[model samples]
Target: MNNQDFPERTCLICKDKKDKKDLFRLVKTGEDKYAFDEKQKEQSRGYYICKSHECLKRLSKHKKIKVDTDDLIKMLNLLKKGEKDYLNILRAMKNSQTLSFGMNMVLEEIEHTHFLVLAEDISEKNERKLLLRAKELNITYVYCGNKQQLGEIFGKDEVSVIGVKNKQIARGLIN
Candidate 1:
């Protein structure tokens, strides 16, 4: 038998035949344990699903089980807090007179920046420039959310980058 004679697996969701290697293998490890075989080395009874998220959703719905993405969920929750904390920091900065926005203002005060937040939708050129400034000034920085979300926090049409002058909030945002 040659590779042409090798058995193909069917996607549980789409009901399409594909080479076993081309599909995601989910193996039943124990009586109730089922995991996607990312490494493709598990020795157990297995089923295949397509790589698309829709396929995963269908499988999850059919099986009545939620796919585990704990790390992603935790990160998303942190991003949510990061957004609210950013708004609070901005408000507090108004009282302390230490907040700055806009590219030039942030670039000018880069040295005083305790933490920097860059919008993911910002232009590559702007991202490169701001990141370089952050690195040169040794300011702690992170990329979170998108331009629209950042804009809502700062009350603008859109915001590319925001620099935090408050050290405490900056620390919280980073961690």
Candidate 2:
């Protein structure tokens, strides 16, 4: 019933704790060696990983990993390069794009807390995730048709994507 009720161990990756019985421990015993320790008998520097592949990727790249007690975390393993690149792309995407809402919504649509721009008849090739994210946000979405027209209304060079960020994000969006 309680987290502390179990015999727990902390995950070296997320620094969260789980019952030690559930975590899978990986130990680094030598320069290029790794092993899974079921009994945790090995004294070598070890880490615990959760079952998800994404979390496993996070574990492999996390900086505090120690192959030996004194060894500085020199670099992540080579297989994580592509995953690291993917994270970099996500960082850039967040900075480059954002959602906007109709100014009229401030007066006319108090009933609707959020919105999704449907881009009524715009090209779907590039703005796909923007649409999906709108649905995921469960906002009031509209398909105004014609990216060019939408861009004109928003005074942007191109427009097929937009979202009405919640109050928490509104301040950040404004500044």
Candidate 3:
């Protein structure tokens, strides 16, 4: 049998088809609707967490994301395979003055950029507005999957609130 003959699995994040590897598959029953199917819980509109902060960072920096087929393949190698700790991130949220993931990605070592990247789903207008403002203020900022990653860096989860190095909310989301 050829690769085409084999049952194909689609990723919800990038919306591409590939035989299951280490991808976190999801099933989307309807438009903008999806479910995490760890057990292959019936292909509906499965999404995979293959798009990690790295890829998100690149797109954010470029200020655009093209809906391309290969882009989907690129996403597959970027994200993590499972849910991260929201709580530990929460704790870090409280302790650390701030956290940012993309554009100014949090590498093992960070040199500068006194800004915070709020990772969450927002409109293009919002993204542009925030980017402009961050530039105006000379502050670092980026958006990601959710604000939770900010919390994770802070050692907790479900963080509705995120702070920057100066102990204040980032202008992007706060505004």
Say which candidate scores most in TM-score: 1
Which lDDT tens digits does candidate 3 get at residues 1-175? Answer: 7854665665444556655653555555454444445466674644554435543344334322233344444443334322243223334455454654433243321334355455565446546655665576666543444655544554556443232554343343333
Per residue, candidate 2 scores C-alpha lDDT tens digits across 30-102 of: 6454555656788776566543334455655555543432222222232234334433332333443344434
Error of 3 at 143 (Å): 3.0
- Best candidate per lDDT, number? 1
Badly placed stretches (over 4 Å) of model 1 are 1-82, 91-95
lDDT at position 68, candidate 1: 49
Better of 1 and 2 by TM-score: 1
> Relative to the unseen true structure, what is the C-alpha lDDT of residue 32 in candidate 3, on a scale of 0 to 100?
43
TM per model? 0.52, 0.28, 0.32
- Candidate 1 accuracy as TM-score: 0.52
Model 1 lowest lDDT segment of ten: 70-79
lDDT of 2 at 103: 33
Summarize candidate 1's per-residue lDDT along 61-169 as a digit string, tens digits. Answer: 5654334464224434444665566666555565465667768888888888898877767899998999887787788775655777667665777888788887876
In model 3, the runs with Cα more than 4 Å from the true position are 1-78, 81-91, 95-113, 147-163, 166-175
Q: Report the CA-based lDDT of candidate 1 relative to the real structure.
A: 0.68
